[model samples]
Target: MSTFRTASRVDGNQSTIVASLRRIGCTVLLTHQLKNCFDILVGYRGRTHLMEIKDPAQPPSKRKLTPGEEEFRRTWQGSPYHVVETIDQAISIVTAP
Candidate 1:
């Protein structure tokens, strides 16, 4: 099984993202921890993908990434792990994985 998670200050965008993912046949898991951990989790073709979503208008902070997120990036270098800036970007990440 796969779990998809995202964080949003407002429920509108969050709900929209989750609904979009489901439309693409993804199972979305709305969580607080997974919000910062990763944007989404995708299980397809026997593989699992972890995603991170960020507002494009919002630049990446110099602050350190989470240990799990950092480890995920290192171990799955070739996979599609991205920081999404907009709804389009979020959809792109979900579709990529």
Candidate 2:
């Protein structure tokens, strides 16, 4: 994730996005154990939501998930996890009733 850290420099943006989401009445979860975990767990009106956020500058790359994260994702089978490139995409997921 250091590569991503260098490319996007999104720590500030991520925090802003989280605050914006919270301001607009969305429940946001911040997890320290999981990398790229902020805004990862969001439950919509009636739908289960799972999303991973990345910066556009950091071109697509695959990385192996730790066993715990993998298991958590697997356990939440009903909701489809989405890899999102922007905050709007996350908002869409939350507000798509």
Candidate 3:
């Protein structure tokens, strides 16, 4: 039997956001497996962005960050991170001037 392990399940819109970012010449890396960390790392025009993907289909309250995610966000000392719920927001982030 193969020994490959599957990654954690991600938000519903994450794949679409990743594809959209890639289509717009942004480099997308999935980082959801990192415990208590952001979901994606995107690079564009010599800049880097960290994004946490939330499902838009869920209620705003339901989309709240998990304890781990909140802890990461609270303790992270890097540049400001973003939380995106839609393709447009993801695209806007990397494409913005």
What Cα-based lDDT does every candidate model obtain?
0.55, 0.57, 0.86
Candidate 3: regions farther than 4 A off: 1-7
Better of 2 and 3 by TM-score: 3
Clashing pairs for predicted structure model 3, backbone only: none
List the pairs of residues colliding in candidate 2: none
For each candidate, what TM-score against the reference?
0.50, 0.58, 0.85
lDDT score, candidate 2: 0.57
Query: What would the per-residue lDDT of candidate 1 be over residues 46-96, giving only the tens digit for each residue?
Result: 555565554444435722456766776677756566544456766665555
**TM-score for candidate 1:** 0.50
Residue range 1-97, candidate 3, lDDT tens digits: 3232255668888889899899889998899877778899999999999999999898988689889789888888885689999999988887788
Q: Which is superior by lDDT, 1 or 3?
A: 3
Native-to-model Cα distance after best TM-score fit, residue 45 in candidate 2, in Å: 2.9
Candidate 2: residue 33 lDDT (0-100): 35
lDDT of 2 at 77: 51
